[model samples]
Target: MIALLGCGVVLLSACGSMPVTGDIKAVDASQPGDSQVQVYAVAPRENATPDEVVDGFLESMTSDDPGFRTTRKYLTKEASRTWKPSAFTTVLSKAPNRSQRPVRDSDRSSTELTFTLTGDKVATVDAQNAYQPVAPTAFSRSLHLVRQNGSKEWRIDFVPDGLLLGQSDFKRLYRSVNKYYFATGPAADQSTLVADPVYVRNRTDPITGMDTVTQTVRSLVEGPTNWLRPVVDSRFPTGTVLRKGVTALAPDDRNVLKVPLNKKADGVGQRSCRMMASQVLYTVRDLTSARVEQVELQRSDGSSLCVLGSGQAEEFAPDGSSGAPDSQYFVDDEGHVQRIPGSNKGSGDPEPVAGPLGDGPVRMSTVGVARDEQLAAAVSQDSASLYVASVVSAGELPRPAVTSRAKKPEDRLSAPSWDGRGDLWVADRNPDDRRLLRLAGGTGEPSNVRVPDLGGARIEALRLSADGVRIALLLTEDGHTTLKIGRIERQGDPDTLQDVSVVELRKAAPQLADVTAMSWSGRSRLVVVGKEQGGVQQVRYVQVDGSAPASGVLPGANQVSSVAAADDEQLPLMADTEDDGIVKLSPGDNWQTVLKKGSSLVYPG
Candidate 1:
């Protein structure tokens, strides 16, 4: 048996108080945020793999499973550290690995390990859950511990399931650990080759008045290769799109064009330096390729192409067209990008597609999407599911950037939206016991008993109805956040989601503070929730077409938290009265109390 020490009292001079789970208490007990979070300490050893050290450190922090403890015969004293063992292994080195919840019903769900010491505090052993851990994610975990209290005692804590790699971390981690076949493209040694391609949506924006033909390619250098695919993206108009030739043989058999590089043109001097590969046998790369943010495709003849992969935006320009964004285009047969002259910076273009489907009501702010299904909030302050409207983008990451702000604590209109298939999505702070009850009128019904992500510590304002599925969640850390809207896929439960598409809000209106109260409005327009320099809550709209945000700031609504818009109808925010009463916003300057006094307002959906 390991000796229980009274060192905690000597080490921590502060008065006795319980530290929150997963919170890192200062070893020095200084003012908060002033000290570094000590994850682990190590005595330098020879020839140890980083993973080995990480594993050893994690092993020291967990409680051994009774089954494992029996298998090993007894506990080893060499693994001793400042803290006792945890309930599970932080690393993916053993059995009982972690698994995602069958479905994600809430806005945020995370899988983590907790380490408790003999004292009052606990440490988070979540380091091994890095986005791109070398090993596949694990579900099995064990805690190794010394006999505490002489009774083989173990305190039980809940690690919410359904945690997966964060989108940003997942992007990097997966890319780092997974070996990917380079999507090959035609190799260009030095000589330039040119080709032509057609029959696709032209790479241009009608809203910002940015046309493909009007652009030119100033130069061409091969960009990064994914799965062996050649790429190019030059922000200038000329560099915007590429002309990829298609050897499309069957129009009905397949929807996309794919063409093999003419290998017949070899030995042309320019041939050695310039190489080409098989494209979809066509000039147009589909929206799948456009999912990666900052990529644009063009075809030969500069006729048609795709801008954003999942039909999202690239840069959020005040005037629509992004300047100097990560751009991609196609090369011609001679390995030369033919469209020499392109966009003149943000000289202006048409509005980009704001989001999925068409104009709807302000209530559309509360929306969620699952491949074919959608659920939205009702303005009547009741929870209900609505049929989702289908929308498509030219980009690959199909999810949309919802809004920028989180709702104030427990704000209803700021609650979650529903994906079509099965999952219920809410803000980080969603009420744990929420349910999905379907609203009448739709042919189908919303999934009940759905699981949610609940990314934030508390649920705030949430709205999702039409335009596009939008989810706005607040994070407990520094109050920063992530807003999501777009397509989703389900795994098990009716409402559990497996994957989601990232709708580049850059494709939406390029305006900050356009979102008034909620983090996201709809996929089309996000309600600006942040107050500009002044404390006034201005209501702005993002068109989703890559132009400036709509100039619709409703003055006088200082405390506006959620705003919804119907087609051509006035957008309204959940206005509050001093008495807590809620009311629909009426025309006025900033700071007007739209609701009667003492009416603690709930989100009117």
Candidate 2:
């Protein structure tokens, strides 16, 4: 087990002894940024033999090329023309090994050679950009090589359809890039663009960053990544192509990118044209060292159709496009929903909200705020029932949304979560009936959510993304817990209640043996509280792609009952530190007590 940082003692009074002071503080906010510059190795010597060819090919597969074009040189003419590296990509946890023998020694002029490859498959990415989880599996492959026609030099005849790379090489060779896709929301902001992240080669050429922008634009025009296709839509017309005969792309001196699309974009709507331009701007802005203030969409003749400036881009709330809220909402000492005004400014005083749930007779054990922040869903004190209430004075009294029929108090309901579309989601913990229910907004019928491959695991906690497309779940089976992410699949008509299903369930934090709680820190990052196998409990940040970064311990707190973060990345992370009350932590900051008297705290995303 790894030793935790910031060791200290924090004492807690009996649960009811904490007080609710009406005082709040102001907190300073900051943002974090990053960059990736890659250096690729030179290609193998031209006169290399079969064995040398195989070695060089495998090594070059990990290079930062827009395509596996560099690795194709090791193959024969016909084989190279038939090869498709992007059909699938296998990511290995450790480096792969190839057989020492690349040819049959007995027959010097043998036309065929084979190289055996082996590795532990960690994950696989299909052409559609879907990441499928695989167990720690041992797999082997055989590559066929042959001497081309009359040439003594051996070239690969047949190879796998995908690219293979070690974990270290993946980190060094590729960079995560965000392509914008529109989120479905209310009519007022229905087509709001949200970021869908995908990994692309860090650079086309190691020297200049020119190819990065071109590669990104090509991927965006290819349509939303496969995993995000169902939940989001793109504005680029189908079959849109760059200007004829243009092999590369770069912004002009004015830092304005003029993207020439094919005739497919001929008669597009003005709003959609602007949105497409925004998608391009957001995609290439960070990739270029030049200040990109705007992206212009044009016809083949170079006539400008629309232009989107950096100032006009509308990013998702979770992307920190919208500033953090002035305060965070939590339950007061009386179990009433209250706000800590100016939470980003270090304000800690409690202020009751102007709503029925604020000071009403109803008391909740946990609460979830809608993405709009006007309504809240809460669990009753006993946890047997779920309730929805207005957080504004213009609303009505709290009403029971769903109640469990379980006789055992322990088998009640978990906390509720609100998606970007305002639907409330919760799981019934009753062992007799493990059901994930969705309560539609404004009197819509509740429906069961189909969870794929749930097996014998019980749902301990679940949180939805602001885009309403994915869910983070903590499941327990056989005394062990696992954290998994699944894509939400909605079928049928929206007017009539439809069945909601979860497909492509993949492990998010495969290293964590026990996950007690989790919350989305961003569209692609989740802050999880759990313990690794044989490790002590701790809090850490994990990417949806299953990358865990270093994290500090919660000072003075031994155990955390729950964890939460605002959808706005600028806000700090708040958690109910078990016996230590409520504490908050900002990036590069230590955990500090924000409320010395509250439990089940949360900052709705």
Candidate 3:
């Protein structure tokens, strides 16, 4: 791989209006002894024993499965495509017993393949057949092991099921290997080896009344090559409309998004990623009455439990104790508010995390919504509290993951959204790692999918586009703003991240400051920004081909703080400011509000 170092000049390229690199460093591997699933490179000794690394990896795959969750980060395009056939599960399933695992056969050979590298032109592979003796079965097939980058780091993948029958391709791949390449038919097709679908929703078009639900989208992840590419299966109905629509009685929109969180037993819940299971998440309703009415519980079963938000305004005294604002959070099936206790905190407003936030730092954040029912919010800083709702870290975790992501306290939670069964996407930043984060997976222990890292800049505001594809983060460093845009998932090599781009606000909206919040008008090709300076709100857009400047800069938005837009083409920017009340920036550059105290607005579920 040393020969490829010259390619650094060819490879490429965050949001926070005034973006900065967080300096999230990779963990120091040399620090005496440390623990983390990571890749290491040691100087080759005079006669270092063969490709021991590959042998070790095969062993680790069975014994220590840590690499399963983060392998995509290091995969090349070809390898990632072959191994991660689908985008979601490349990081979704890690447990040996999950349905995604290959079914163990009684006659299968040992589940092991060791690689030995002797020099530039020669290498050897030893296989431990997986089929067991009881079911003794032997199969032969053609396989290829290709090197990625310049390293002897080889990947063994099948070349389409039976195409190998043609000797030409086989000769092209294995003609140089020792003897004839060792053969073992297909292990389970990786596609069938996915962790079963987590969340699914069944929605019907409101006007047409046609079903919009489709079969389950196994895990929120699929293979990197198949990203954003919809998969249609006959098992469930298939159709999509402008929106993800409401709950129904079918498998597509199975209706209940159950998330499995990423957890480690630290006595109290410490910082980690949260896996939002199958569920569709929606934003909070725009508030009209400013009188702080009450918080209530909305369950997946469609039941409502009123919360007495009065006396319990800011306390964390359990469910029925001290009448705290405990009900304002998300609740699990056991009726317990799933919280991490001491992990919540807020930015610049240090009132000691009053109430349910307790004494946590109050930088609590959220991911998306849960199956259209609850908002995912991290209620603590030291640990994560599900609040039945919402939504960081570093070598603190790994690379790609560290981008956009700041350190623990800074991984301030973002709202979480459940795709249906249990797929969740949480927003976080690690300035230290220069990466943004998307914490994906179940509630037990989440898989951290790193995005292009955004450093030093503080993410004053962020929001996922209603279309569910785009995400906007308003970044600020020393209170200055900059905007960064990139794909939602982290795929490919841990050292090689794809699709992370930054748009300088000064080049777009030069007058904006402390760009606190942002959201995508998904379809209209626009990004809505809420500027803190004089509450100046602006709507800007970039073309897939990179044309035109951010065109829709309104002259009067002195009070808007939050926004949400689905009909991005008709109305691009929605501003909720103290002075502007509610302003809608649309086709005619209009301005108006449908409600007040619009701290948040949504197309309610």
Best by TM-score: 2
Candidate 2 local lDDT, 1-605, one digit each (tens): 01111231111111112224433222110011112423232344655666677766776675554355666777777888988877877877666787845454757447777888898887776675445556567878889887777667778888888888776666555566777777642221445566676666655633223366776787788788766677677788888867665445678898888888878887788888988888888777777778788889988678988887777775523344465343677777787787776544445677777777777777778888776677787787788878777776556665577888777766789888877666889999898898999887734556898987798888888898776778898889999878888887786766678778887777888777888888988667788888877988878877776654434244334588888876666678888876667888776677788787766666654
> TM-score for each prediction?
0.28, 0.82, 0.31
The TM-score-based order of candidates, best leading, equals 2, 3, 1
lDDT tens readout by residue for model 1, 354-400 = 22322332223233333222222222112221223332332222222
Question: After superposition on all CA atoms, what RMSD does each candidate show versus the true structure?
Answer: 22.0, 12.5, 25.7
Which residue ranges in model 1 land beyond 4 Å of their true spot? 1-459, 465-470, 474-476, 479-487, 491-516, 519-523, 532-536, 542-552, 567-605
Q: Looking at model 1, which ten-residue stretch has the lowest summed lDDT?
A: 175-184
State candidate 1's TM-score: 0.28
The true-structure Cα RMSD of candidate 3 reads: 25.7
Best model number under lDDT: 2
**Against the true structure, candidate 1 has what lDDT?**
0.26
Q: What is the C-alpha lDDT of each candidate?
A: 0.26, 0.70, 0.28
